[model samples]
Target: MKICVIGLGLLGGSFALGVRNTLDDVEIIGVDKNPEHSQKALELGIIDKIMTMEDAVPQATIAVIATPVNIIEYQLPFVLDLISPMGVVIDLGSTKGNICKAAEDHPKRARYVATHPIAGTENSGPESAFKGLFRNKTMIICDREKSDPIAYQFIKSIFKDLDMQVSYMDSVEHDKHIAYVSHLSHISSFALGATVLDMEKSEKSIFAMAGSGFSSTVRLAKSSPAMWAPIFEQNAENISEALGSYIEHLKSFKEIIDNKDMEKSTQVMNRVNDIRRVLKGIDIKS
Candidate 1:
């Protein structure tokens, strides 16, 4: 089987590594806009051969779009157009609604599957990829009925090989839920990182007193803006709602602490502690 992976960053390169490690007969072809990234992926053995988008799409039995959400929107229709009748085109865009809608009216829409694998690190690029990155992670397939039955089954089998647990959701619900869980968390991390850095520049020795707690909380801030900026734009409505709730909670907490009402603060924390139970069953990632 020939697989073409576009956008040779952490997600794309990691996917190539994961699938290659799992399947013996698979030939991996990489397509990237950056020559430097292609070279790096080659050095890391993430892809077997580097090819351009035009040269690779038709040759591929499967084409995986691992680009940023914005790129995926404009790129999906083109990929569907290039794929053979039996070929499957799967996307790994974080947001779902816009990407699914982008290819909704395409003649070859059935050739595409809109998917979001709920796994990633704050790192990116070919050098950052590793095998098993998606292992045991949740792979959400949106608008399942729109994809051809044979193509849908083919996608499920691939994710199963990678040890991903498959789940189905409507594209609209996927976007709304991810805003609170994934998007909001990233925004918080970025905001916190900026707050501390800005404070440090004003003469407070912040980093000197920082510890693992701070490190863990702010880790998502290191994620590439090239990738995240598009996600923020694409899912602004949902993300904005999530942010409003997060901000209201912050204000409530601040008011409690400012008034030195330790009893109410303790109650709030005790209630939030239930999240430990919710997260315990899963392999948690940022």
Candidate 2:
């Protein structure tokens, strides 16, 4: 089968690599707005060839939209218009509500599947791509009932080949859940990184004493702003709610510390440690 992958950045390049590694008889055609990214994907052997979106969609059995959420919202309908009736289009974007809603009323909506692979590092670009990036990760399919059964099954099989555990949810619910679980984490990391950097200007040798815990806490701050800024905008309501709740919790903890209520603070820590039980069910590495 021939697959056309749009936006040959980290997610797209890694997806191309994962598919190529798992499927022997597949041809991967890459499309990127950035010519440099397309050329780099070709040089890295992530795609069999680079083609314009206009040229690639017609030849592809499946077209994967791995672009930023905003671009996915803009380009998906155009892609659906170009692909054959039998062709399937899948989007691997982070935010789902806007992208899904964009194509909701299209006549060829049944040919499209909205998916979010719940995985990635705080990295971007084709050079960061690698095989098995989605292995053991959660792949969420939104509004699966709206997609044609055959198309849904085909894309599910492809994610299965990449070793992903697939799940289903409504598009709106998916966006709301991810705002807390995924988006809020990035915001926290970014805020923490910024706070530390501001402190470092006044306390010049601060980073020299930084340890692994600090590095881990701020890791997601390294994620691409070009990608994340759109996501934050698209899922603004839910993310804002999540941030408010997080801030309230932080204030509560601060209250406990300010009051010197060591026992209450310890109780709060012990209560949150219950998350370890939840994490044990997932394949989180130490």
Candidate 3:
């Protein structure tokens, strides 16, 4: 099988590697807007070769769009136009509602599979793509019923080979849930980083006190702004709702501590401890 992965950033680069590793017979080609990323992908053995969409789309058995969310909106339609009847086009955009809506009524609407693999690191570029990034991770496929059976099966096969567990949801549902679990987390991390750096400006000695907890929380703040900014804009309404709720929660906790409401503060702490139970089921290493 011939697979062409566009956008050789962390997601695309990691995908190319995962596909190639799982399906040895599969030939992987990478297409990147950045020439350097293409070169790095090849040198790192993430793909068999580098090819353009014009040269690869029609011939490829599958085309995966791993670009940023905004670009995916415009790119997916063109990809659907290029592929044959049996060719499948799957996208790994973070936000799905807008992109899915864009391709809903196309003549080749069935050829597209809208997916968001719920896994990543704070790193990017072909150089940062790593093997096993998708392993055991949950991949959300939105509006599966709207996709062609063959296209959907083909996509399912790819993720299965990568050891990703699949879950189905409507696009709107996916967006709403992810706004709280994923998008808001990134925003919080970024805000936290900004806050700490601001404090450092007044007290340079604060850096010496930084520990693993601070590092872990702020790590996502180093993620690519180019990739995240569009996601924030695309999911603005849901993200704002999530942020408002989070701020309100934080304010309540602050009031409890400020007024020395020991009973209320203890109640809040115990409730928040449920997060430890939730994290226990996941394989994240602290």
Candidate 4:
């Protein structure tokens, strides 16, 4: 099988590595707008070769769009146009509703599968790629009924080879749920990081006092804006709703503390502590 992976950044490069490690007799072709990333992917042996979209799309058995959300919207239709009849196209974008809607009426709509693999690190670039990044991670396939059975099965096989757990949902529901579970968390992390940086101006020794908790909480803030900006825009409505709820809870907690209501503050902490039980069943390792 020959797979063409667009945008040889962290996700694409890591996908190439996973395929090479798990699949037999497979050729991985890489396409990236950045020459440095292409060269780095080659040097790191993440891809077998590099090719232009025009050349790679026609020959690939499967084409995976691992670009940012905006680029995925722009390229998906063009990719669907170029792929052979039997070829399958899949996307790894964080936001799915807009992307799936873009290709909804395309002539070859059945050839494309909308997927979001719920896994990643706060790192970017080809050098950040690694094997086993998708292992045990949940892969959400949006609007599955819109894709051809053959195309969907082929993608399922690929994710299974990478040891990922697969689930299906409508595109709208995927975006709504992810807004709370994924997008909101990133926003919180970014906000926390910004607050700390602003405080640093008044306290030079603030970072020196930071420990593992602060580092872990602010980790998502290191993610690339180039990638996340489009995602935030695409899911703005749902994310805003999630953020409003979060802010309300924050205000309630603050009020309790301000009133010196120790019992109420303890109840709030205990109630939120249930998340530990929920998280015990989630595999977030990358």
Candidate 5:
């Protein structure tokens, strides 16, 4: 099998490496908009060769578009046009509705599979990629019925090779759920980081007093904005809804605190403490 990865960033590079580590009789070709990333991916053994999409797509058995969500939307149709008749195209972008819609009208839409792997760190670039990044991660394949049976099976086997758990959902539902579990969290982290930095400007002791809790809470703030900004924009409605609900909770908590309603505050926290069980259930499932 021949694999062509469109972006040689963390997800793309890690996927290529994972395929290389697990699959035999395979070749991986990488395409990056940035020449520096192509050189770095090649040097780091993330891919066997670096080639342009025009040269790479025709020969690839599978083309993985791992670019930012917006770029993926713009280029998905073009990639589908260039892919061989039997070839499959899988995307590792976060938002699925826009991506699926972009290629839905294409004649070769059956050959495309929209996927979002619930994995990553607060890092970017090929250097940050590793062989096992997707292992045990949940890989969500959206609009599976739209893809050809052969193509769907191919992606399932490939995700199995990468040691990921697979789930299926409608593209719209995928975006809505992710807005809460993924998008909202990133926005919260970024806002919290910004809040702390602003406060720290006047209080030099803020950094000195920072603890592990603060570091962990703000860790997603270090994620690449180039990748995330597009997601926030693409899923704006769902995100806006999530934000509204989150803001209401904040307002309620603040009101309780300002009014010195210790009993209500304790009751509210006691109700929210169920999250411990919710998280524990997720861990067990994982």
Candidate 6:
């Protein structure tokens, strides 16, 4: 089998490594708009070869679109138009609604599978790629009924071999759920980093006092703006809704603290403490 991974950034590079490690007798080719990324991907052994998209599709048994959300929207349809019916197309974009909608009426729509792997880092480019990034992660496949059974099975086989569990959702549900768990978290981290950096400018020695909690909370702020900006734009409605709810909760806490209402403040603390317990129950380190 031959696999062509479009966009040799962290996600694409990782996918290339995963497929090479897990799938025997498969050849990997990479496509990147940036010539430097293409060179880096080859230098890092992320792909077996660097190939043009026009030359790659006919020979590729599977096409993995790991580009940004907006580019994925444009590339997916073109891939479907070019690949054989037996060939499969998979996208690893974070936001799915727009991409799914773009493929809705395509002639080979069933050959494509919409997927979002619940794994990533605050890094970008082939240099940031690492092996085993997707191991033990959950991959959400949205709108499966619209996919061809053979193509869907092929994707599941690949992810399963990588030790990932496959889950299913509709595009709307995926967006809403991710807005709370993923997108909102990124926004909070970005805001925290901006706030702390401002404070650091005034308190020159504040870094010495920063603890693990602050470090962990602000980590996602280091994520690539080029990648995250389009994702946030694509899901603006859901992101805005999540942000609004978060602000309301914060305002309530501020009111309690300002009034010196010990009971109310403790009640708020207890409610927030319950969240830690809930997170613990889910096997998450809170």
Candidate 5 per-residue lDDT over residues 159-199, each given as its tens digit: 98898889999999999999999999999999999999999
TM-score of 1: 0.98
**Which model scores highest in lDDT?**
5
**lDDT string, candidate 6, 1-286, tens digits:** 8999999999999989988888889888999999999999998998888889989987889999999998998999899988887899999999999999999999999999999999999999999887788888889999999999988988998999988889999998999989999999999999999998899899999889989999999999999999999999999999999999999998988998899999998877877787877667545411
TM-scores for candidates 1 onward, in order: 0.98, 0.98, 0.97, 0.98, 0.98, 0.96
Q: How close is candidate 3 to the true structure, as a TM-score?
A: 0.97
Local error of candidate 5 at residue 135 (angstroms): 0.6
Lowest summed lDDT across 10 adjacent residues in model 2 is found at: 277-286
Would you list the clashing residue pairs of candidate 4? none
Candidate 3 wrong stretches, greater than 4 Å: 284-286
**Residue 63 in model 6: shift from native, Å?**
0.5
lDDT of 3: 0.91
Give the residue spans of candidate 1 off by over 4 A.
284-286
Number of backbone-clashing residue pairs for each candidate, in the order shown = 0, 0, 0, 0, 0, 0
TM-score quality measure for candidate 6: 0.96
Q: Write the per-residue lDDT of candidate 3 for residues 1-286, one digit (tens) a residue.
A: 9999999998988898888788868888888888888888899998888888899889898999999999999999999999988999999999999999989889999999999999899998888898889998989999999998877987898899899889899999899999999999999999999999999999999989999999999999999999999999999999999999999998988888889999998888898999998897665521
lDDT of 2: 0.94
Worst 10 residues of 6 by lDDT: 277-286
Q: Across residues 117-199, which tens digit of lDDT does each residue of candidate 2 receive? A: 99899999999999878988999999999999999999999899888989999999999999999999999999999999999
Clash pairs for candidate 2: none
lDDT of prediction 5: 0.94
Off by over 4 Å in 5: 284-286
lDDT, each prediction: 0.93, 0.94, 0.91, 0.94, 0.94, 0.91
At residue 80, give the lDDT of candidate 2: 95
